[model samples]
Target: MPTTQHSPQGHGHAHSLAQGHALDRSEAKDSTENGGEAGNMPNLSTLSLDELKQLDRDPEFFDDFIEEMSVVQHLNEELDSMMNQVENISRENESKGSHLVELKRRLSDDYTALKTLGEKCDQLNKKYLKKSEEYAPQHMRELLQIAASNADADCDRHVEHFLNGKIDVQTFLNTYQSSKKISAERKAKEERLGTQLSALERAGI
Candidate 1:
């Protein structure tokens, strides 16, 4: 009889008929005694003596049985390997999915904060622009008041010269009227700027 020995490369086609078993009893016994292999395989202890005798009478039948058992064992090993791979893939997917969800949540929060900050910036810009616009006309009016005072002083000097007979009445009238005309033009420009400023303020600019 051939010795009952397991090999990593599996059995050859030519197996000893005297050592052939109906079920993988030797392998099962090794498992029970030594915890040699994993999973459930066929055990010859489950077969009747009469069945064993019948299998012993036919070497072909025993050989076929051994072949079938080898095939089943190989298939079980492959199935276990596939199951392990599937489990690993599932764990990796779960971890990645959790990380992706966290990233999406952070991105959403960042977008919301950015939008709020942008709105605040827009509000500040508008406030600064409106104040600048309002101040511009006020500054122009102050400069115009200074210019008008200077012009009035100049006209008063010309009138004094005319009264002292240092200049004629025609020259005096011309100089004074010219100054008044310049003052009128300045007032009209100031009124126009004031109207524009009021319109801008009303429009919330």
Candidate 2:
């Protein structure tokens, strides 16, 4: 079976995008709750060293900062779990997709084989029919008649044996019935084949 390549890069990129979107939502909510305008959102990296030191020394500011960091940490852990789930799902999809592709390929091959077999069957049938027309009509009629005659003789023999106590009732019925069935079928076939023979004779074939 052919193998499918599933690069980790694509899966990682997708998960990263999802994590970024989640963080963005969290940041937006934090900004709204703080009653701060988007433009006033401070970039810690842009702050002067003295300004950062001043904020770090403020107890109230530090408490709020720690609280916010805790929320961000929790969100990161949740995002990590989401990323793992997405990775598993991606792997499962790849496995299932590969199996599906193989199944389709096998089905296609089987269908092609069956189509070829069907065509050959049709060709053989046409050839057989042609040969049957060339030589078999009279032979088939004679065979059917002979089969009917033999079946009738077998049926009469079975009945005679039953009457003479050579066979029990059950054995006699089973044998006689089977012979009669064969006789009936052969007689019917002979009649039908006789019609075909007559047609062939009239057509001078």
Candidate 3:
């Protein structure tokens, strides 16, 4: 029996041919799956050693392959440029989202502060209005009028006491004169305040 020996170069050549055949079969299957239309062809860089070797023997195929490789290279560069733009847009959108969130937080804080301030203002206004009412000119006039009326009533009671022989003449006169002065003064003050309040109302103060 005789044994056959294979050279390294022959083995490599056979392997390359096998790879080319497999690639062709794959392209044929892809085309069939795509309704028998030729799909995207593989890049020249992915060509088998056997296919590359054909460049030396076929000048027309070589030129066409070179042109196709150039188109593929241009398309790859454009795709890379587009991908970079997409990445930049994504980063910008993320930054904008963060900024918008911060703005919303600040707005909420401002609204809370404004609400607190408004509540405080309302409290102060109510307090001021209560104080104003207590010390109002019309209220003071009413108090004075009440005091004047009480003085007149006391004088009338003292007169009755004198007439009933419950008080001396001098004591009754002294009390009567003092009560009259007080009543007159209070009446005068009440009239003055009333006049001032009327003027204020007329002027829309």
Candidate 4:
């Protein structure tokens, strides 16, 4: 007869182990079908601090544990390097954003200034045109009329031949003829001056 062992606790433990294995297999199959990314396993990250403490205190496992210490140190250094790179990139992007805002502000200011300058120039031009229309030809006409009158006065005074003594009929008749010629020339000058004033007034400038 073969001896058989029977214990309720051992049977329960074997059943629990079998169930755990089955659940692990099913989860792995689902993960593979979904092409899931590498994620921390719950069993790994959930290790109790007490469990790690106990392991560290064990003398027989010390050498083996410390053998992997350098690898952990190197991994920490790599993590630090990646974090620095990320921070640097973030700072550069922030600076670029600030620069872009400043440029936009300056451009807006320049556009506003240009618009104001254009409006001012238009107003000044209108003022200049209005003043020019009121003043130019009036001065020119006054100058021309004054010059013609002065010429007439000079001619009338000079025709007498300085006669402070008695004069003959030949001298008086010659002086009268010369005065008549000068009067006609003065009349022509007066007419031409009027014509020039009319032309300047009509032209509006």
Candidate 5:
């Protein structure tokens, strides 16, 4: 459809003029000095859409009129949150370090105590072993000597009976030689064993 352009003549758009108080907005904006310049509808036709949007960002124009308290409060809250997080991290790090140090100290003390205890136990065992070594051979020798004395007493009775002449001389001589020879042989064997045993002891075997 073609636009029927209104004219500035007596009767171009009587309907546009006919809208009553709405058109009287110009009259309302009129002050005593300047004509209705302030009341005029903004002629957005002069600016591109992007340029009009940039107008709100102009600090010189908006800073004097806009309320900025909310922006300041938001920034303050963010800074406070960041500071709290940093403080928490520092505290955690300090606690962890202290705990690790304490654990290390405890471990060191435990190790030291265990080492000393082990040394004492080893020394005690060595002392007992030395006592056992010193006592064992002497005890064995005394036991053997006691057994030898008992055997010697039993032989003395038989030798005395033969020496009293109640038995024949030939018989007594034969029995006595045989018995004394056997005893001598046994004593010599025992002496050989004792020498070997002493050698082994001296060699720490």
Candidate 6:
């Protein structure tokens, strides 16, 4: 029978290769258990070409790397979707804010217009009240009294002229009678107005 033996260097090389494969499998299992977290997975893009080639040569490691890459891609897509939703919400809020501003401005304008209108109405009401007061019963009665006194004075003047012979009897009689009639009518109106005012006062009007 012939004898065969393995060299010491060959034994050491085989042991190192076995250790490298075991380490790679352990890392891959840890990455999978952790749900392929970014920190646990290697960044293949940053790897040198020679390192990538080495990884590609290992079937189990390449498969694990591919799975991790897929998880990263899915995460990136979800993040992009979330960012797009945030942008859309921000745009909607901005539009609502603009509408609110416009509404506020319109309300301010309406308030100012209402205030001006209120002031104008107050001024008109004051003017109307003043005009009404000028034509009140008390003032009208005063005017009527003055008119009656003037008529009486005119009648007296006419009588005097007639006595002085400056006016004829027919003319004096006509003028005096007209003056007396006017005085009587004015006095009657004044008396009637005073009576009505007194009645209103008694009634608390």
Q: Write the per-residue lDDT of candidate 5 for residues 1-205, one digit (tens) a residue.
A: 8988756774746666777666586666564334344333344466676656765677764443233335545667899999999999999999999999999999999999999999999999999998887567555555455555555554565578778876777776676676556566555655666787789989999
Q: Which regions of candidate 6 deviate over 4 angstroms? A: 1-68, 149-184, 200-205
Could you give candidate 2's per-residue lDDT for residues 161-199 as a string of tens digits? Answer: 999999999999899889889989988988988887788
User: Better model by TM-score, 1 or 4?
Assistant: 1
Ranking under lDDT, best-scoring first?
Answer: 6, 3, 2, 1, 4, 5
The worst-scoring run of ten residues by lDDT in candidate 5 lies at 32-41
Candidate 4 Cα misplacement greater than 4 A, ranges? 1-53, 56-68, 136-194, 197-205
Candidate 1 or 3, higher lDDT?
3
User: How much lDDT does each candidate structure score?
Assistant: 0.78, 0.84, 0.89, 0.70, 0.68, 0.92
Residue lDDT tens for model 4, 1-205: 9999979999999999999999999998998875533232223245478756766797655555544455555677899999999999999999999999999999999999999999999999999988786455555445445655665554454444435435565775666666556656655766776687788779984
Clash count in backbone of candidate 6: 0
Predicted structure 6, TM vs. truth = 0.53
Model 2: how far is 5 from its true place, Å?
Answer: 97
Best by lDDT: 6
Error of 4 at 100 (Å): 2.1
RMSD of each: 18.8, 27.6, 17.1, 11.2, 17.0, 9.9
Q: Candidate 2 versus the native: TM-score?
A: 0.38
For the record, the alpha-carbon RMSD of candidate 5 to the native fold, in angstroms, is 17.0
Count the clashes in each prediction.
0, 0, 0, 0, 0, 0
Query: Model 3, 1-205: lDDT tens per residue?
Result: 9999999999999999999999999998886797522224535567788888998789998877865754566787899999999999999999999999999999999999999999999999999999898788888899899999999998999899999999999999999999999999999999999999989999999
lDDT of 6 by residue, 13-72 (tens): 999999999999999898778864656566777988987997879888776676677566
In Å, residue 92's CA in model 4 sits off its true spot by 1.8
Model 1, 51-149: lDDT tens digits are 688788989977766656755768878999999999999999999999999999999999999999999999999999988875787777766666777
